[model samples]
Target: MAPSELRPVRRRLDAHEPEPEDAEDIEEYPDDGFDGRVRLDPGRRGMVALVGVGVAAVVLAGWFVWRDHPVSQPVPALPVVVTTSEAAEPAVAADLVVSVVGAIARPGLVTVPPGSRIADVLLAGGGALPGTDLLGLNLAQKVSDGDQIVVGAPAPPMSSAGASNAGTSGGGGSGGGDADDSTGKTLSLNDATESDLDALPGVGPVTASSIVAWRDANGPFTSVDQLGEVDGIGPARLEKLRDLVAP
Candidate 1:
């Protein structure tokens, strides 16, 4: 055969030859600027965007719920107010009125305690005048209501010659000793004056007056023990005066 005819025959034979056994399979790809990237469909892209939006909306809703329901704080308690009631005070006891007359700066009626003694009345009367015979009166004795005290001049001291005469002439002696009969023997309760009765133990001026008043009302006491019949003079008091008084 000719060379030209051989070239056309070789071309036909090469075209009919089989491919290599070790050749790699190539996948078809489209060119859109990004290489080695997979392209998604429009519907698939829309599904992914919807899922992202739904997750974001869920996170936003959780944040709003947490904001609306915040943790609570404890409240403080209020202070209490106290109220008090006003009341009036009670009345007190009144003072006792007594008439005080003697040798003093201001001798008249004076208010004193219920159990004022003679010394207290003397002080309330601006004290005794100079040279007033204080020993003649019972300074330790308690005074009563409307009592009149006379402050007399002291008796002149008896001379030793006159003291012997006083012993010889008994009736000629002064009668001032009669007021102090308690210094001697038993006193007669039926004849005793209120001042003499005041010398008895536990027998104040008030009780002495009550005794004289009882004797006047009920006659003379029959027995010395009958002194217990008087008010404020109980068995204990009568027992004290048993050796000191006579019916």
Candidate 2:
């Protein structure tokens, strides 16, 4: 065909136009004002938002229920008051009275509480008197009701001359010009006074006084066997005086 006579004819077709393979393979993105652009479907985003709101509502409801519920624990009990018509009474103490005599400065009855000792009784009696013998008494001993405490007088001092005279006269078996002589009467083992019995064998002023003291304490003796009752009189000493006394 000659160039001048060749012509192209245009006609509209009913079928859709086929896309180019190269153009279909190429992707075109819209410009967004961000470095990374992402697209999501509106329906899918709405479903995700609804799920998040439902989860939040459920969490809030659980929190509210937890805050409103009462905790499981034991309740505190109220204090109880005990009232008695008859009140408890105090205990009564025992009353004790003691008498103090002999060698105490004030020799008389003393009123004291129960469970008091003899020392307390002594203190209650104005303490001990001068020259009182405290050796024979137990001051710490407990005192009961109606107890009597007697403190003795202190013994007198002994002189050398008196001691020598006592020893010489008290030594048995000596009939010389010593106190034991023929003219001297045999001393009574129980009731003889010191001056009356000074001449007896093995009998001194102290021993004679001790004999009288025994008589005063135990009453008159019926036999010489009771002579042993005197202080410082042993069996050997009594044997020596066996023939010297009568009933």
Candidate 3:
């Protein structure tokens, strides 16, 4: 074998020298003098770790407290007030004054409620005498104030003085007064019926009813002249009736 092809002989190492290695076997390494990051000592590192652990524990405790209960704003209260009021009173209707007479239990002046009827007047007069016929009376007719209600019997006859005020001829009206008892022909203004007044010259049924209504409203006539107060009885009409009637 050629000398060049022979294996390189390895030298034995001495105690004072370093061992030699082949160039191909030696490895290239990067420079490693020191790192850019700051390093701490064992004691300092331990203190930093302890401080971090303490900070984390404190943060965790704060999170737990905040999750359980939160802060809230307070609200203000308002005041209440009370009030009182008075009630009003009701109104009452006025009563009417009327005269109830004739065959009733009690015949006299009586006060009744307004818009009362003839039946009410009968009740006010202690009602008509027992068995008294009511078929002749208009119990449903409305009565006014100062009205005279006669029940169960005829009206009383008029006296001479009252007849004189009538200015009427007797049962046989001759348009003038007659002094003789047999044919004196005296007509009582108070007792005279509507037919009697209608018989007077120039007096009609309308005028006669007006007279009766006026009498019913004003009571028995004090004088024949008072008839002038009736409605539709103007000064001219009154003059015509004045001679036809006395009073």
lDDT of candidates 1 onward, in order: 0.66, 0.64, 0.65
TM-score, structure 2 vs. true: 0.30
**Full-model lDDT, candidate 1:** 0.66
Alpha-carbon deviation at 55 in model 2, angstroms: 62
Q: Model 3: runs farther than 4 Å from truth? A: 1-91, 155-247
How would you encode candidate 1's per-residue C-alpha lDDT over 1-247 as one tens digit per residue? 7898799889999999987655456555667876867766659889999899999999999999999997999988888876657666777645544444445667766777867776787788788888766775677766555454444423323333334444555453354354233234566788788877765544656668888988998899889877877765655447656876777
Rank order (by lDDT, best first): 1, 3, 2
Candidate 1 lDDT score at position 110 = 70
What's model 3's TM-score? 0.32
- Candidate 1 Cα errors over 4 Å, as ranges: 1-91, 99-109, 113-117, 135-183, 193-212, 222-247
Task: Please estimate how well model 2 matches the true structure, expressed as its whole-model Cα lDDT.
Answer: 0.64
Lowest-lDDT window of 10 residues in candidate 2?
A: 6-15
Best by lDDT: 1
